[model samples]
Each structure stands twice: as C-alpha cells, then as structure tokens.
Target: MLTLPQLRALYPEAPAAHLTAFAAEAARLLPAHGLAANRQRCHFFLAQLGHESGGLQLRTENLAYSAARLMQVWPSRFPTPEAARRLAFSPEALAEAVYGGRMGNDRPGDGYRYRGRGYIQITGRETYRALGRLCGLPLEEEPGLADDPAHAVTIACAYWSWKRLNPLCDAGDYAGLTRRINGGLTGLQDRYGWLERAQRCIPWPEAGSEALPLPRLRAVQRALKARGFYDGSIDGIIGRRSLAAIATLRAELGLPGEGLDAPLLAALAA
Candidate 1:
C-alpha cells in the first residue's frame, strides 16, 4: 500500500493534506481494480499517473496555452499562429474544437463538459460511459467525480485494468504503454523520470504480500542505521530497540506512526 510519506517524497511540492488523501485513496481503490497485484504494476501505474496528473495535483487537463505552444503541441491541429490564435488561451473553446464530434461526443458542448479528468485523464463521452460501465460507477452522468481523488484513482486503475497494462509494465515496455495511454510518445522522458522515481520509492516485494524476508529486513535495518535512523543491533530481528528506532525515524521524517511499512523500507533503502 502507498503511504503519505511516499507520496510526499514523490511530490514534494504538493500539499500534505492532498498527499494524505491521495495515499488513502490509492490504498483503498487500487486493489479493487487489481492494480495492487504486484510491485511492477504498482510502480508503472504510479509513474504514469504521477506524470499524467502532475503528481496527483492536476485533476483537469490544463488547456490554456499560447498560440506558439498550441502549434508546437498540436502541430497537426494548429499549423501556424494564425491558425492557433483563435483557440489560444481559450481552454473551453479549444476543447470544443478539438474533441467535438469525436469519442461519442456529438452534443453542442460535450467537449468542454467531458474534457479530460482523473489521474489518467479519461477523456470523451464514450470513455466515460465505458469506464462507468466497467467500474460500475456513474461517471458518464457525474463526470465531475473524476476530479475527486477517490474516483480519480478508481478511474485510472479501471483504465489501466481495461488496457491490460500489467504485462507491458512487467515487460518494461514503457514506450508501448505510453503509446497506448497517450496515443504517442509525448513527454516520454518525463515519464521515464517518473518511472525511475517510483522504482526508487517502491522498490521490490512479492505482490499482495507485506511480509519482508529476514535478510531483507536486516538489510533495511542496516540501511536505516546507516542513515542514522536506527542505532541498534542489526540481527535480522525487529526487536524493541529497532521498533523504537523506527518510531523515532518516522517522527523525525514527519511520517505517520505506521512503523516499519513498505514505505519505511523504501525510504531506508534510499
């Protein structure tokens, strides 16, 4: 399960309250969508979601941009500033122009109404409807729920499950997954960076299991001691002293008093 401390480390700029809520929501929702089956799936999902949602800070897609940026990002749609200027700085107008008459959005103002929202930015009326059906939610009727952290995590996990991204994630096919999620290699480097960061934060463990092996536990204790979090014997046993050390470290790091969790192990390793 993800912890607030891990989320805080991943998104240092995000508010602490937001990270707390996001961690709780992730722990609650990810398993239901089968995203907590393994560490690889968790890491890959978090990396992509972290990148897409701007570390769980951006629920709605920011469409506001200069004409030059519009042309650069959507060259096919805006070949020049003369063509892009009308849509520039007008997020709602841009949404209507680009997303209208597509993805089952044939209404007058469906684009702006169904603009991308959620951790993975589930866009379009059809997508919302389909995800609603898949996840047994009222996303189509209440699209704004995507902006809520709880629903955003659920929507992203549902999308990930529907796409069968775990195998690709296990295969380390980030480019392929990126193409599937983004329809192109946009922000590939940033995605890679997020992946690296997630790997560092999550580390390795058996899927769905929280029990750390003895050797691994000893290694973690050693790591903590090296980082001045623990100053006890590293005998592969979590003794009272070790637990006290862990509590002290948690207090020092502003982590919750959840003692010796996967996040602590990851932090110790880092």
Candidate 2:
C-alpha cells in the first residue's frame, strides 16, 4: 500500500536500487507481518526502520571511528583519547574490544562476524541464530545475507515480531519502543521526526467504513493472491473473486464470517 513516491519522500538519500527493493519488500512483507495493520504501527515501524538503517541506506554497521568520535560514542569504554586512538579506524579491533565478550560472541572473530546487519541492524551471534530460525535462513552461518536487500526487510520484520514491539506502538509508547529497540533513547528526536513525516504521508482508515480504502484493499488482494486463495486481478474492488478468496482464507483459518474486519486483516496478514 505504500507508494513508491511516498517511500522516496521518506528516504530521499537512499540509492535508487535500494529504494526499489525496499519499497517492493515493504509492500509484501509489512502487511504480512502486521506492521502495516494501522497508521500508528506503520508510522512507528517506519520511524524505527529509518532511524536504525539511516533512511534505508545502510545494511551493515559502520565501525570505523576516529579517536575523538570513539571517545564521544563510547566514553565509558574509551575514557581517554589515547585509549580510543589505539583502536581508531580499526573496525575489527574496535569491534573485538567492545563486543568480544558480550552478546554471545565468545569466539575470537565473533565480534566482527556477528556485527550488526539488516534494516534494523540486527547484532550478536545469539540474535542471528534466533532470527535465522524464525526466518528459516542460515543467518548465523552466513551473516552477510542480512546485508542483502532482499533479506534485510525479512530480518527486520522477524526482529520486530520476535521482540513483540507492536503493543508499544499500539499504546503510542514511542519512548518504550525506542528503549526496546536501541536499549536507550539514542536518536529519539530523529525517530519522532520520521514518525511525523510518515503520519503525514500515510493516511489512516476513516471510521464507520466497512470496506477498506482502495490501496489497503489492493494490498489485501495481493496477500490473498500470494497465498493462492485469490486468482483475480488486483483491482481493489471487493468483487466475487475477492469475497471468495476471503471466504476460503477464513475457512482455512477456521474463522467465522466473510466480513472485512480487524480479525480478518490480522488473519490474512498472519
């Protein structure tokens, strides 16, 4: 449902290829993951995604830092300038020094090996193994796959789901969500800016409407088609084919009725 133009507006600095891939993947995966369930969820998800991925431009963590930068970023770890200078510009050494004994990085090279990747910057060996199981991908064995654009969104969505962060979004708890995602309030203002921009770009459903808007209906149609429950053209109209597809999906999920409601949307998304 997120248009290409809207995505471009959201991430003007992203490369054209990255924008295209992210747009397609978001359209397919966001709804499927229930991240697009409502305006709040969509805006919150995009805000965090934009902030974490640097507006969808970065798939891997940048460990290269100057001594002054290192001193500022990790003051507790590198208290003095001389200490920071030792690992300055040495990404692998810095990674090892800071991340070696934490986040399930016990092996010699596990620091760099399990460094952050993907849209949300998934980090750590334990996280990679867990997400790999959720996504059915060998992320722990081949961490670089998280850098691939196709897999990045999947990893992000899986991470979001695994963390069960949607309720915070539903509760409008941006600070709570940020803490869960970043372990702190880092870049909180920037995330709020993205959320404001997303709110302006993406419209919410009007109250008292039984049928979804055209764009959302089209998204549902696409989801149904992907699941082989619908074979009709995705014209955004709730025609016989669409209804039949919904009916079939409801039957499979053991859900009652053929109505378009929150439960149906959630089921289709699931």
Scored by lDDT, the top model is 2
Top TM-score hit:
2
Q: After superposition, how far is residue 45 of candidate 2 from its true place, in Å?
A: 0.8
Clashing pairs in model 1, backbone N/Cα/C closer than 3 A: none
lDDT of 2 by residue, 51-153 (tens): 8888888778879999999987688889999999999999998999988988999899899999878879888999999999999999989999998877877
For model 2, the run of ten residues with the poorest summed lDDT: 206-215
What are the lDDT figures for the candidates, one per model? 0.78, 0.81
- Give the RMSD in angstroms, all C-alphas superposed, for model 2: 14.7
Off by over 4 Å in 1: 15-17, 206-270
lDDT of 1 at 8: 85
For model 2 the local lDDT of residue 199 reads 70
